[model samples]
Target chain A: MANLILLKEVGEAMNKAAIDAFPNECCGFFFGHEVGEDRVVQEVMPVENSKEGDQRRRFSIDPKAYMDAEKHALAMDMSLLGVYHSHPSHPAIPSEHDLKQAMPWFSYIILSVEKEAVKNTTSWQLDEARKFKNETLKQL
Target chain B: MAQVIIPTPLRKFTNSQARFEAAGNTVQDVLKALSTQHQGLKTHLLDENGELRSFVRVYLGDEDINFLQKGATPIEANSIISIIPAIAGGIV
Candidate 1:
């Protein structure tokens, strides 16, 4: 299992995204590098939704965000190590849909917020066959 | 024979089949058989260099193949493999 670390900035960013997308859903990607032993967040890419109504909260990464993330990672010599999205009213964990979409190598982070208050946050890594296995998150 | 569990996004490529029996002694061989049966799926699972794509994950039963032998991970007749893609989204 790979170790995961969420920097304080990541928490703050997630919180902001959660609040910004309240009553709906907010999604974004987390870019960072492996520093000696831990993954650190260097950038956050939040994209506008193309879907209509509450369906926007279901989750999807904008194609533009992928290009931007790739550019940023190349510049920093880091990788797109993880992705983060908020559960407006749900807990921070991988839903069944999340499991189906989880990539094996990237860390998946979920931020759970209620009424603008951060409730919980967690990260997951995909197993060989792409099942999400929970990973401990250390806040830096 | 090995069982390959298809994830939803990739089901279209597999003719909407969720699982299929593939013949192989190793993960690579099984994947090769799958790709041969479902054209274009190999591109989704492997990079141009034949390396597992960073975004695709393969699991043997409950264990990740990466922790085992990667594409070379041995597979028994009844082994089950799962393919998962990375998905992300939220309200904004």
Candidate 2:
């Protein structure tokens, strides 16, 4: 499995954001560079979940927010490697909706938030079959 | 001529080229030139009805074209157009 390298502090920050969002899902971006088959995360940028109605089960980054993040990544000289989102009260697994919405070439880091606490963290990527395969998450 | 910056995900359709210079007087023209140059990119940027996909956001300079004149937004010779795909998903 491919691995994604994240700084301990960066990982902690994602966890905190997940917990903070609580009953609702939290969405964000990860700015990083690719090292061979592995991705090294340098920053975690949280964005507003623009999905209207039932935010707890869904999350969508506003078009403006996505553009802003792209510019920010460009300014920082980093690639928008992937996205991170929390699944409130659900496991850190990519749901069917995720596979349908996801594009190739970006990693997805999912945080499992259970009762205002983080439970598990998992990373995923969409395969050629449009299914998500788990990626190893390494925090250092 | 306007420079359209293609996001990383869509670069594969452009032969992995990040940015390409296209000739047009408006956002629509430039996009038309882009799709004409890279035939594989047409569907990704536009749907069957030829409308920009909901997940695909096009910006004329720093402003989203949607807030401007949309596809009819005028462009300068050196204008920069950026294509950003929305990052979204859900637990369900």
Candidate number with greatest DockQ: 2
Steric overlap count per candidate: 16, 0
Docking class of 1: incorrect
Candidate 1 local lDDT, A1-140, one digit each (tens) = 45577678767887888787776667777777677656777677776544454643587654444545655655776666767777878888778777755654577788887876878888887766667788778777
**Can you write out model 1's per-residue Cα lDDT over B63-87, one digit (the tens) per residue?**
7787899999999999988775545
Candidate 2 lDDT, B1-92, residue by residue in tens: 78999887777789978789978878999898899899978877899988898778898887989999999999999999999887778888
User: Model 2 residue B78 lDDT?
Assistant: 94
Tens-place lDDT per residue, model 2, A25-112, is: 9999999888888899989998888989998999998877877777787888888888899999889999888877787778999999
Q: Estimate each model's TM-score.
A: 0.60, 0.89
Chain B structural similarity as TM-score, candidate 2: 0.95
Which DockQ values do the candidates obtain, in the order shown? 0.17, 0.65
Query: How much lDDT does each candidate structure score?
Result: 0.72, 0.87
Interface RMSD values for all candidates: 7.4, 1.4
Best by lDDT: 2
Clashes of 1: 16
